[model samples]
Each structure stands twice: as structure tokens, then as C-alpha cells.
Target: MNDDQATPNPTKDRKFVEALSRGLDVLRAFSQGSVVLGNQDISRITGLPKPTVSRMTYTLTKLGYLAYSPQLEKYQLDSGVLALGYAYVSNLRVRQLAKPYLDEFARNTNTSVGLTCRDRLSMIYVENCRPAEITSLRMDVGVRLPLATTAAGRAYLAAMKEEERRHVMSSLAERHPDTWPELKQQLEESFRDYEKYGFCLSLGDWDRNVNAAGVALHLQDGTLMALTCGAPTYLVSEEKVKNQLAHQLAILARDIERLGV
Candidate 1:
């Protein structure tokens, strides 16, 4: 059975391990707003067999990544998962070092500033700073956005190494054959804009409620990340983003990079 719940990895070599893949798919089955899941639920989500999901879930529970509920007869992520996620955040020194700058920028601009890192074919928010008064935008840490359409994702593609970007784009195109052409054109334009302004814009392109500009940062730790700053559409215009927010985000991205240096 094919397990393509998240992004599809286009190339699989002989070193690939199916069992490990299935196990990770089982974990990926637990998504945002998903509380608990039984083997059947995971099976349907991952397209794996019920028996295989049962075996994988049992193994995961034994390893402390999952906890079983006796009354509900389902499983939920446990401490092991939290530890892994926490370790990732803790090791990213940029998250701690950049927060103050982000907060200051967000507070001054009345916009939301978010730090994101690429995960597979999407970008996941690592740190978020928003003005307390702004309540329309809801992006926070752990929120994931599509790689092809988002300002953050386009900035990531513009900044990533060519070979790595090609690999990711291949998977994206293969997965979204119908939309890839248009999205690819937009990404190319974003690249040119990134060259001129050091930032990319998605003015209601991804979410109509949001108007955002993004820029990329290359940390001293060899990590590549993206930064986005935006407000709700009603509060910001495309010209305002290009003339104001974009420059602020680009400057913040450079300052954040200097911290890692």
C-alpha cells in the first residue's frame, strides 16, 4: 500500500526502509486539532493496513512516543514526542536570539512577524511575534503552510541551494501537476522580486485575509530559515507591504542572521 499522507518523496533508493517510513507515517497521522486516534483511524489516514498500523502503534507506544487510553481504546502523542519537538526548538539558538527583535518589529509595525523553517515540502513556524492589539491573523509556532503559494515558502525557495531547491520543486510538481505551472511562474517572479527588494510578497495570494512579505536568512549554524511580517488585508495594502513591511522584514532577516554569526 502507498503511504503518501504528507508530501511525497519522489526518489526512494535501495537504502530506503519501508517499515521506518510506515512508522513515521503513523506519527504524521496525528495532525493539528487531532486529539486521539485508533489503528483504524491511522490506517485510513496513512493508507497503511490496519494490522500494520496496529504493529507500528504498539511499537511506538512501547518506545514512549505514544500513549494508549484504556477507556477510549485509542492513542495520543506522549512525552517522547514533546521531548523530540522541544529538543529541536531548544537547539535552534536563533529562536531565542531573534525573538526580541521580532517582538520589537511586530510591536512597532502592528503586524505579525513569524520565523519559519522548511519541513519536507512545507514551512513550519518556529517562532512567532505579534502585536497584542492585532487579533485577526492566527499564525503561531507549529503552524504549517504550503511550500508553493506562501510568501514564506517562496522566499525559502529563492534562498535555498539550487540542487536542494530542485529536489523540492520536483516533489512539488509531481504532487501538484495541475497547479505547478502557475505556481512555478509565481515563484520565478518572486525570485526576481527577492533579488530587487530582498523580500517576497504574498498579498492575499495564499490567504485572502492576510497580506505578507517574506525574506530568507542563512544562519551561522548552517540553517536556512524564512521570516514573514504581515497584517490582515483590511489593515494593509500591497503598496504598503512593498514600501514598508517588506523592508522591515528584510532588515530583520539580516539582523537575525548576524546573531548566529
Candidate 2:
């Protein structure tokens, strides 16, 4: 099981609202693959009692956060949830500010460019720009990738201060106990590469057909973000990524950092 599946018990906090947390748990139980969920399914996923799940689903349905189908006796997310996500994306100044630059870079390179931020043990894409021609790699806004495997995530790790990086690495070690040894070794190599090259490359590490390079920078608001360019492994050679794309991405990172300053 993925580490994200282990939901923390926020209710243990003094200021935590258990009901609100449980309600969110019910809403989050639905995902890309499991779009529709019965009360029992939600209960199992959230580790909540059946009665609690039933009530939460009923409330969510009434609030338009979930839509219930009478025939299948299942619930799916409604448009209201999208409004919440839209509120987040629309309010991000970094995304609004970076669009034109990222678009130009994508067109010039004929590859995909993305801006991502860390979300726990994952890197979540906030913005993505793609060239007209389609490539084997497919990434979009809101997509999440493992922090230890992707070029964007490695760049983020490299950008963090030493103490903070150590804290996050410890958390990752605890979360993915079995894979820590291998992941740590790979991360150490990435850190060394970043120090030497000003960017890090992931050649088919995250996805077998994807080759990507990325650099990290801070936004005007001091938010850490990574900008990445990616193409299919067949289309981009490792040498070209290391010697060319990495330098270009580093320049882009510096340009973005200047905007924030």
C-alpha cells in the first residue's frame, strides 16, 4: 500500500474537529479509479463506522459535494468539489505569472513543461504547458508523482535547506520503510548531480518512457516550486538532457526566481 493510504488521525489534536475531518475523509475516499463509492466502501476506506459514513454521505449529497445514484446506491463527487479546486488554482499568482514564459519554453523545445510543489511525499503539478505535437509522456494540472522518483521532486529536495530536507527525508523513510535504502541512494546521487550541474535529470526513473530534467526556485511569496521539461525517452537522449535541457531549465528557474525577488 502507498504511504498516502495511511491517513493520520487528526482527531487526536486538541483543536481538531473530528466531524469535519471525518466528513473530508468521506469525500476523499473517491478517486480517479474509484469514482463512485457505496457507504460501506467509504467506511472501509476511511476507517469510520458505517453509521458515520452514511451520515457524512447524506450531508455531502445535500451540500452538493456528492451526488447519489438511487439505482446503484453509490455516491460520486459533484461539481461543487471542482469549485473548491478552482478556487485554489485561480488564486495562485505563480501560475498566472508563469503561463507565458512556460508556454514559450514548451513551444521552443517541443516538450512538456510543468510547475510543481511538494505535497507531503508527492509533487503535485500546479501548471502544465505542452507543445502542439503530442508525446508519449502525459502530465496535467493536479497530477501527483512520487517525490523520490521524479525530476521535479528531486529538484525540490535539492532546493530545501539542510535541516528541512533532513526532516522531510526522515518522514519519507518512515512512510516508505521498505524502499528507503534504495531511494536514499538515488536521492544522494541526485543531490550530487544538482550541485554539479545546477539541475537534476531523471532518465526513465519515474516512468519507463519518460525523460525529464528540472530546477527549483522560490516564488515571490517564498513558495518553493520546481519547473520541469519532459519528453519521451525515444525522443530525448540522456546526453542532450544533461548537457542542453538541464542548462535551459536552470536559466528558466533563475528567470522565475528573479520575478519573485
Candidate 3:
């Protein structure tokens, strides 16, 4: 199932193991720059009790998912964590199936093209194709952009069923309580544009220097994915993105959907 789809709360589900969830949360507290984290740091980030954080850290460290640093008194993610992500990607063949078409599209548009899917509150890039020349947005596999602000994410939201879209919006509201009002308005506009153009545009919304447009499609296995192409704001104007690139992205989405992979 798409990770974006809401699952039953582990806290309320009798069969759910809350400990596992907490352990994962502790690991997630570490990001690209914040690689090493102490128990108190994790507690503050995850809002878990200090004692619980200690226990989870110790358990994860013993399981090889986290490695404790003796000199710094902090924990860092170990290579074992990559195995989990690798397992997930190895099972999803979309990247392999979409690479050639994405490559051609990137070359034709002289922009950066990416294939991404909804992952919790963000869109995670699974495949990226770049033209020979350098581009403004430098994204690789595993890069994540906020779902409420990115073109790929907006397209994904626009393509979802109304009930699913509402559920996702409510979750976004809770996660970003302060920015939800403005984000909601932006998303409403995107939905209207999608209805008229078959795609959505994000013009310097996520990043001031970059502009992207995207279209979403469902694969043969019923997995929802988005195709996005982006370049520097000066190079790719909103008019060009909406009139030219958006149609190309929509055609690529349809081609991938026809692949039935």
C-alpha cells in the first residue's frame, strides 16, 4: 500500500507493537545533517519520554540499526538501516521501468526529471534523470520534498480520491498547524489547475530559485506515482511550464501508466 494512505494508529490498535513504532521514530529523528543524536536530543525531537528514548536507543543499537558513539555519547544510524530501504526499493520496479522515458524527457526539455511517490508527509524521489548540463535543483534518489509545496506532491494530491485527499489534508494540517491555512489555499488552486490542465505547477513555491510542473499516474500494481521536471526560475517561466512542460509531463505519465508495471 502507498505509505501516504493512513494506517490504523499503532497506539490504538491491539495488534500493533508500539515499541517497534517508537524505535522507528527514534531512528527517524536523525536526518541528513543531524546524523548523531543523544537520548535527550531524540526525546526532544520525538516527544517521547527520556526513559523510553533510552530503552529504544539501546534496543536499536543492539539490533545494529543504531550505533552508539563512546566518545560523543550519541547514536548514529548504521548501515543495517539501509538494508530496510534497499529491500523496499528492490521490490518496486518502477524506477527500472521508467528510466529510459525519463531520460529522454530530461534531454528534450534540458531539465531535471524525477519520479517520486508519497512517503508520509513528503514526496520521496525514487528515480532522477538529469540533462548533460547542470541544473538548479540537485535531487537524487531518497531526496524528500514537503508534500504541501511541491509540484509532484500537488499532482499526487490532485489525483487521489476525495476521501483520501481529505484524510491526507487533515494529517498535513495536524503536522503543520501554523502553515495549514496558506497551504490549504495553495492546494485548492492546484486542484483547480489540475482539473483544467491535467497537471499542476509549482512556481518557486518550494524553492525560490526553482520551478517545477508535474503529472501523476497509477501503475499496474495500483501504486500512485508522479513525474516532475524542473529548472531554474529564470530559465523556466510559469507560462512555459504550464503551456509546454506540463503537457510533456502528462504524456510521460500516460506512457508509464500504459507500461502496466
Candidate 4:
């Protein structure tokens, strides 16, 4: 059924609401970090009753948005979901607006450069460019990465409105129990740096052997995206990574801003 023609506020009605909202909630319970969830776990996470969650899970599995892992008895998002997300990005202004700049950065730096945007709580890769020599780190379009532990995520977080940032921090506290303290400190420092100099850098924080730097691509519409450069530790030192790449990053940001990224 079309979204506009679907039951209106069926959540208030006892009949159609069960299959409508609960199914969507079941799909939402899975994320980049939360790839699979058992019925009980889904119930706890979504605040839906155990039986309701069970029915919703079964329904979704039948509908192809989710798959049932018999060994784990957990549900995971299927590849079919990518069709929906990719359709949105394929038509996005950011992809067209940021493409040439990313291509130029990769050519100049001879390293990987990418553009990512905030999707609720995760960072979705919209564009990527890398040198032909680097064959290990295979980043694809539409790949979702956790924002709390990525340079692009931290940069986006730092650029958000104060209230939105608070909500993100709260959700991070709840979603990531192990990395909360370190992530919080990193976020604070990055935000300060971004505000002071309009760019952010992280070294070996997201992954122990990788380094990255990023700058905000702020558009006039209040929507923000981040352009980031990522490479191995040996290739990106603290001084050169932050001081040098930051300048190039700023120029790219300006170019994107002019085009409204």
C-alpha cells in the first residue's frame, strides 16, 4: 500500500496498528552494530511486547526485509533493504554536488576520500574514491557505518545543532556501553577543534591502525555532510594529517558549500 493511502494513525486503532507500526519498528531495531536480534532482544529494544515482537518478526521474515538465522534464531536485515536506501542516495543532491570534489581529492592525495551523511543515528556512505593500489579497504556506496566510532560520524556530530547533538550523545550512551566514555571525550575534543578551526582529525581512534581527518560541508538548508580522508597510520602522521589535509579539506568544503552540499 502507498504511504499516503495507508491507514492513517492506525497506531491509535487496535486493529491495523499491530501490523503497521510494529513491523516497521522490528525493521528499525536492527542497525549497523545491531545486525541481528532475537525475538526477546527485539522486544526489549523496541519496548514492544514479546508476543507482538514475535509476530512482527515472523511477518517481516516472510516479507523479505529480514531473514531468519536458525542457528542464532535471530533476525537480520536482508539485502533487499538496500534497494530502498540506494534509491534515495542515487537521486540525492549530495552525490551530484560532492562527486567532482571527491574525485579531485583522491587524485591529488592518492588516498581514499569519501562523503558521508547522517541518517538518523548512523553515517551512510554516499560517495567514495580511492587509489588503485589500495585494494584491502573496500568501501562501497550505501554501506552504513556506526557514527560513534568513525571520523565521519564524529565530524557530523560536531556539526549538528546543540539539541540534536545531545540526543545523539544520549543514544550513543545507551547503544554503545563499552565505548561511551572514550567516544564522549573524542566527540568533545573534535567539536571544540571543529568550532575553533572548522575541521576535525582522528588518529587510530576508530580503528587501531587507521587515521582520518574531516571537515563539515554545511549547506544553506541546514543539512550537513562530512568529507573525510582516510588512510593507514604509516601514510598519515599527526602533523601532516591534521595540518596539511585540513587545508585541502577546507577548500573542498568551500567548493561543496558553494554548490549546496
Candidate 5:
């Protein structure tokens, strides 16, 4: 059999398979900018074929994860996805522990704060506190940012265990050539610098006008997520804010760690 084909594995094979993953991916493909998608759009966004996306959409609609607009011939994410994400987030130990600290950080800094965990090659927002100025972008709960672009994602990558870090960075190298450069030496140097400082600062790496800084909030299990702060570049410039903001974020992380948050 080819590598693309499923291997015969007695130990790994399971009777209770998961359509859950594919369905969730389809739902995730619908985002803030693209609220509804036709089969072709879904196919392009998800890398799934048109026929497979059509079948999944039909099944998802039946299961209530999607709702189809007959006039537009497009599918929009239904309320069911909220319930799924809500259930997961509601039960997460990190979200529970991070909320109060995030709130405090936002209030103290008078800036927006977010907590993000690694999800595949993306960073999934778990908690956030946005001041009105920052909320203008409508960056709210359940936002996923590219791991190679955002400060929180870079911070998480910087904090990853050795083997896991190699795997994720390698995948990023393969998947995003235009965005991800082939500069291995520079990447390693940046990671080392972040490790020395305990945080990472990104300037216009994700969004051209957005400046962000983040520090890892470590868990006892050796897993870590990031506490991130972001603003428009006009408000926080690259030359002015990287050191100060990173220090502040690191302090917050230390406090949270001491408090076991």
C-alpha cells in the first residue's frame, strides 16, 4: 500500500472512529472574515475535495453543526460548534486558572491580554480580556492564529519540549514556505534568545500593523501556553515596546506560576 493509504495496524485500529475531527475542521474553516462558504470555498480552505466537503456539509447539517442558506448555496457554522467549543473550554484547567489572572493583567496594563494553546500548527485562543480600544478588531473568544506568525504561537514554540519543538518547526518549514523562510540558523538563534529572556516579541509578523509580546505560562506537566498582549503598531512600536512589554508579560507569567494559575 502507498503511504497515503491507511496501514493495517491491529493495535492502532479502532471501531469507534471519529468524524468529529473532520467536522470540526470544516467548522473551523468558517472564520470571522468568511462566515459562510460554498463547496468550492470549503474545499479550497480545508484542502478537502469538493465532493467530500459536500458530503461532510450535508452530514454536518443533519447533525446541526452547520446550517445551509438555500439562496446563497453556502454553509455557515451553526450553534452546535459553540456548544462543542464551550464544553471543551469550560472544562479546561488552563482556562479556569488563567481567567482571573488575564483579567488582572488587562486591568493593570490597560491593554488587551490573551491566553493561547497550541493546536496543531495554530494557536487557539483559550481566554482573553480586551479593552475597548483593542476589541475594535473583534478579536474575541475562540480565535485561532497561525503558529508561525503570532507572538503567542512563537512563545509556545520557544517553550516546547525538545522533540516536540523539532517536530512542529519542521512541519511549519514544510507547510509555509512563503511565510516560513528556510533560515534554520536564524530560527534557532531566535528560539535561543527567547529562551534566555523567557518571552518572545513579534512586530508585524502576523498582522502588519499589530505588535505583540508573549511569555509562556508553564504547567507542572511541562506543557506551556502563552500569555500575550497586543496592540496597533502606532500604539506600541517595535523599537519602543519589545523589551518593556516583554518584561511586563514575563512578570505576569511568574506571578501566575507562583499562584499556580
Candidate 6:
């Protein structure tokens, strides 16, 4: 499973560039919490050889994607990565279109609203809004959530095609083998929620005192995204999440698809 392992069989797929994949994996080793790292840290995180990691860091630094810090003896992501992230998020037409509505909804409901899409085995927030009067979930853009845990993630899975859902579930199971049975049961229940309620609910399942409801949007070009409405348990009643907010979110999603260019 290590990147240094010779049989990186996924590379056998057509047009799957192994070296590029490995380099990207190296870049991904850096996160918000992991601000600076050396070859050994990246090697340990990525399961690639130290020498390979060294070479990757050198190449990435040369390409302006990473900066070498002689003082710290580590690497930090450079402007290249920032530019890429900024450019991608800025150009998301759906996020742009949904912003006003999402902001208004958040303000009116005194909750947090987020739009997210799948990233690997998780959902990455593309846009998020919160009420100015209340501080709810502090999750922001780029925050990732487990694909089976959050209401947004469950709504996303419920919206996927059957075969694709099976593939994703298989991946999730592999990623969490021991907990798969419990999580799978939760997903089945959430799917039923989606069918009956027009949205999915995560009733403090992701945390001890959080409640959330989510609806999925399938865009004209087939881009799938999920919109989530969430708040602290004390702030939002489960009855409101199940009966009111969830359905309201579903209507908002439909409006976004119908009206957005």
C-alpha cells in the first residue's frame, strides 16, 4: 500500500501516470495542521521511500509548488498551490450562484449552510455560510468530512447512481473495515430518510451534540453537490431538522438547479 511499493497496480489503468500521482500524493501530505514537513515526515505520511520523497520535494520546489526552508529544514506549500486552490474555488459557478441564497438561508435559520462535493473518501466543503447572530459549526471551505457520517455526505451518497454508490461503499468499507457494518446500517437508514423525507439527516451521529439535514443537487451538466443545514443541538431542534429545514433545503436545491446558469 506504500507509494514506494513496486506494484502500484492502479497505474496500470490507461492514462494513469504513476509518477504524477506519486508527486501529487506528496503534495497532499501537507495540510492545514501540517504546515511544514521534511522528507522523513512526508515519507512516513505517504509511505514512500525517503529518497523518493526527497526527490519529489526537490522537484516540487523547483516547480514552485513547495518552498524549502533552510532554517526549519522543512518544506511549506508555495504560492503555486495557493494559486491553484484560489483559481479553482473562484471559478465555481455553482458556488457563485448559490452564495446569496445560502447566506440568506443561514441567516434566517441561525445555522450553518455548506455546499460540498466528494473528494476521495470524504466530502470537501466548497462553500459555507453562517448566521452573523450565532456561532454554529465552524467548518469552512476545504474542511473534509467522512463520506458516511455527515448529513451532507449521506445525501450525496443517496443521490449517486446505484453502481457508483456500490463502488463508493466498497471503498468506504475498505477504508473503515471494522466500522463498516455500523456505518453501512447508518447509510441504509439515511437512504430511507432521503426517500421518504426528501433529504438526509445526521442526528448527532457525527458528533455528540450536532444536528444536520442535507439535500443533494444534480446540476444540468451532471455535477453532483450536497447542501447541508446544521446547527448545535441546543440551537436547532431535531423536529425542525426533520420536518422543516430539510424540506426547505430540498426546495432551495431544486431552485438552484432550475435557475442557475
Candidate topping TM-score: 3
Per-residue lDDT, model 6, residue 238, is 94
User: Where does candidate 1 stray beyond 4 Å?
Assistant: 1-18, 70-72
Clashes of each: 0, 0, 0, 0, 0, 0
Give every collision pair in model 2: none
Ten residues in sequence with the least summed lDDT for candidate 2: 1-10
Q: Show model 6 residue runs off by greater than 4 Å.
A: 1-12
lDDT scores of the candidates, listed in order: 0.85, 0.84, 0.86, 0.77, 0.75, 0.86
TM-score-wise, the better of 1 and 6 is: 6
Residues 121-166, model 2: lDDT tens digits: 7888889999868455668888888888899999999989998788
Q: List the residue pairs that clash in candidate 6.
A: none
Lowest lDDT 10-residue stretch of candidate 4: 1-10
- lDDT of residue 25 for candidate 4: 68
Could you give candidate 5's per-residue lDDT for residues 68-143 as a string of tens digits? 9999999898888889989988987877877787887777665678888877777878888876666554467788
Model 1, 1-261: lDDT tens digits are: 322223444365666777898898888788634789999889988889999999999999999999999999999999999899989987878888998999899989999999999877678899998987789787877888887788899999899888878877777877677888988888889989988879898988899888999999898867788998888888888889999889988988888777754
Q: Quote each prediction's TM-score.
A: 0.89, 0.86, 0.93, 0.80, 0.82, 0.91
| lDDT of each residue in 1-261, candidate 4, tens digit only | 111112235657656655676677677677525878899888877778899888888887887888999999888998667678778878888778778878888878866888888766677788899888656555778667667667788888888889878877877777667877977888899889888888887787777777788877787878788888887777777787788887788788888888854
Model 2 misplaced regions, further than 4 Å: 5-13, 161-167
Candidates 1 and 2, the one with greater lDDT: 1
Instruction: Give the runs in model 5 whose Cα sits over 4 Å from its true position.
Output: 1-21, 31-33, 132-138, 182-186, 221-223
Error of 3 at 97 (Å): 0.9
The lDDT-based order of candidates, best leading, equals: 6, 3, 1, 2, 4, 5
Error of 4 at 190 (Å): 0.9
